[model samples]
Target: MIIEPRIQNPASLLPDAVKAINLLYKAAHSAGVPDSTLELVHLRASQINGCSACVDAGARGARKAGETEERLYAVAVWRETPYFTEAERAALALAEAATRLADRADAVSDDVWAEAARHFDEKELAAIVLWVATTNFFNRINAATRQPAPQTWG
Candidate 1:
């Protein structure tokens, strides 16, 4: 079945908002965090949100940052996968907890936060959190607009 998007590039209609989002998203790429880790967090959050556009883009972005197919495929089940490092595991845990805030009263539990803290310093933690937030923001925008994935895979 062919599905048409509700809006054709909504960001193009809101250029100012698009620029602001672009700027904030750009700033979220902090120097303290690794690009690979940031890509993982973005992909995981997009996966959870079921945002196809994000999933597709995140996968492409992750690969561009030198991520392996195994790691990308295992992102959703990182706990059971040995493809990730301890630090990457901690960041993924934090990303899941932060992204699924409505699932629990204590959305981001202390254990998750503590684990992430053990792996990352203050600045790096801030960067990961910002990446999750921006990813969620993009996911919402894309999902709401029913923006289709641009491609199947790279």
Candidate 2:
């Protein structure tokens, strides 16, 4: 494999940044969102961002969470697929909308927000939003740094 990482791991080089991100992660998880749903959101956002490392890591996390391969593979085309529930579809739509803010004049439209709200309560919705944002943040960083997918997450 090619050496793709442009620099040392930011978590090691900048402990404060890592701590902040870790705190955000902890807060995101405390919102009571399901692990599978969170992983799906992360994977979908990473896919949209074209971040291979995040995609790889998200896929592994989904698998560990008992997500089927068929469902995971269909996440990119979830709208046309029958693999996801209405709730999952809403979350995916929200993730796409939030991640592709420049795709339209009004990103995260009312309809999308309403759909997500219907499926998740306020706290859950907050967690999902934070999860999407955090995933996108990592996606941008990994893409910019040319970080390669790790062989294993351990």
TM-score attained by model 2 = 0.94
Worst 10 residues of 2 by lDDT: 1-10
Clashes of each: 0, 0
Model 1: runs farther than 4 Å from truth?
152-154
Candidate 1 residue-wise lDDT, 36-85, digit = tens? 99999999999999998899999999999999998999999999988999
For model 1, state the Cα shift of residue 56 in Å: 0.3
On the 0 to 100 scale, the lDDT of residue 31 in model 2 is 88
Query: Candidate 1 has what TM-score?
Result: 0.94
Each candidate structure's TM-score, on Cα atoms with residue i matched to residue i, is 0.94, 0.94
Q: Rate the local accuracy (lDDT) of all candidates.
A: 0.90, 0.92
Q: Candidate 1, overall lDDT?
A: 0.90
List the candidate 2 regions with Cα displacement exceeding 4 Å. 1-3, 152-154
The alpha-carbon lDDT assigned to residue 41 of candidate 2 equals 94
Q: Could you give candidate 2's per-residue lDDT for residues 1-154 as a string of tens digits?
A: 6656899767678889998999989988898888899999999999999999899999999999999999999999999989998998999999999999999999999999999999999999999999999999999888887888876637
